[model samples]
Target: MPTITTADGTEIYYQDHGQGRPVVLSHGWPLCSDAWEHELKVLADHGYRAIAHDRRGHGRSTRTSAGHDMDTYAADLATLVEALDLTDLAVVGHSTGGGEVVRYAARHGAGRVTKVVTAGAVPPVMLQSPANPEGTPIEAFDGIRAGVLADRSQFYQDLAVPFFGANREGSTVSQGQRDDFWRQGMLAGLQAAYDCVKVFSETDFTEDLKALDVPILIAHGDDDQIVPIAAAAYRAIDLVRLGTLRVYPGAPHGIVGAYQEAFLADVLEFLAD
Candidate 1:
């Protein structure tokens, strides 16, 4: 497996496919690069160099006990970009990956970036506070931490229901899809997976979003149960200087796979702009 060694010596695993302008993918929590497999194939076929990496402590990457926070996550991604010398890039992130992209663009600067896309992303903020009334309560995140510690396997199984909208009436989400979620969750490092709940839920990206100057596509499902649209994508777009919104009605949190065709089309169109 191909990998890059971060400044901290953490080995980050990655996949590179096709050949053209680069499109780097950042995946969500408790999941790895495999989550973006279909998107990569489609992107490569559409004439773009599609790449993805397993965030440190997830998938094939080193399962280090430290640096599970957002700052380090963005730095690791920055290392990947510099190592590959990718330029005029389009960075696409999903869920937790979305927040990473926001921080990356803000912290490292977008001098080499051309465009950005986030799907069902957690940003602006996810934790309830005086500034964010629409956000979820801290007790809810505490419940997630408990779930991770008490029964990760069962927790992942149950999370897949809402993550992919498998529980919704007339939903076409397959048993395999839910099983896939569990499989991915099981592959992640326990420490990293547990620590990520706080990273995604509590980290405020208001300043980061405001710092991005490149065009951004903020896509969110109206019915996303994990990260509500009102608090995440809705507020995120407002914070970014140049942001566009794509509302997926009746879509779940996993809109990328649930609405693959539409999502891909929207992404390609935005990239071509």
Candidate 2:
């Protein structure tokens, strides 16, 4: 397991495979680099250098009780990319990872990156405010915080129900899927996971999205119950100067696995363009 030591001395675990144009993957909330297993193999086999990392306090990375915010997340990724001496690469982020990459591009500049892909990501903003009146209510995020504080394990188990689109009509969630979700969630530090809920939901990425000069591919499921396309992906596309939005019909938030083939094809297509 290769790891990079950030400026803060946190050992960030990551996977780098194959060669060619680098394609770094940033996994969703509470999940680790393991969540990108399918994408990693596919991208590598397709002659692309696929990279995925466990955010600090998640998976094999160092577990800490502090620095679990958007800025820290973006800085951790910047450190990894620089340490690896990667440039002109494609960054693909899902859910919270979307927030991380968006902030990374805005804060760190687009010199190291060529393009960005956001799938079922949280951007522009997830919480409602006077400026963004249509965002998800603050109380909804508060309820999530309350749930995690109450019982972390049970809370993760429950969150998996909707995270994978299992709760949708005609949708089926396998035992393995639920187990995988729980397994990854359990691997993360409880405090980091809790803190991320606020980071993803409250942080404003409007300016970040607007600042991006590279082409952005926003692929999101219209049926996503976790992060609705309206408040997240749709709005994100409008803000970016060069952005293409693709709505996955009847797709869920966990489209990485839920719509794996389509997701990969779209990503590859975007990168090739």
Candidate 3:
């Protein structure tokens, strides 16, 4: 049970495996580091120092009510990096974690981060606004918040469909995958999970993207239902200083697992470059 205490005294549980250039993984909303089991094992087997942590109120970490925003999420990650003295890093983030990595580089500086991968990440803003008229509407996020409060169990069960494209024609998403997703969602604190909806949706990462200096690999499934490509990864590549795009045709937001081999190969290749 390896852990680190945040400035606010929240204990974050993390996994550190293998030994080589550190590759820290940041996960998405309502998911803990275990969601990254495949990646952790694979990256380590490939000869990299793989690491992941349970964000506050998610997984085995402190279920605190406050500090569920992107700033705090990034700060917590910083705490882990500094505590471990990790350097020359390759950081990977998914969904809301995508916003976290962007914020992390911007706020703490990318001097140590050598490379970054954001798969199915949310960035450059996900909310609908006058300037970003093509974004998802506020009501959709509100509905999410409402779902968390109303019936989170059922909501998670239902959400696994769109999140993983389980309902898509000829989809291979398994019942175990959906059940595991539900299990992870249930572990999160109700308050933290509820608060994160706003963090992922409303928190604009436009300036954060502009501020990041490291070379980033922007990977996303073309048909991602959670974070649309046009509003997220597609537009995010244009905003970053140096970015490469890898689009998975007809894949869903969970492409990292859904297309595991391809995603792993792509990440390893980018990190090696």
lDDT of candidates 1 onward, in order: 0.91, 0.90, 0.89
Against the true structure, whose lDDT is highest?
1
Worst 10 residues of 1 by lDDT: 254-263
Error of 1 at 71 (Å): 0.7
- Residue-wise C-alpha lDDT for candidate 2, range 151-192, written one tens digit per residue: 989998899888888888888668688889999999999888
In the predicted model 2, the residue pairs found to clash are none
Off by over 4 Å in 2: 256-258
Q: Comparing 1 and 2 by TM-score, which wins? A: 1
Which consecutive 10 residues in model 3 have the weakest lDDT in total? Answer: 254-263
lDDT of 1 by residue, 52-97 (tens): 9999999999999989999999999999999999999999999999
RMSD of 3: 1.0
* Model 1's TM-score against the true structure: 0.98
Q: Sorted on TM-score, highest at the top, how do the candidates line up? A: 1, 3, 2
**Per-prediction CA RMSD (Å):** 0.9, 1.1, 1.0
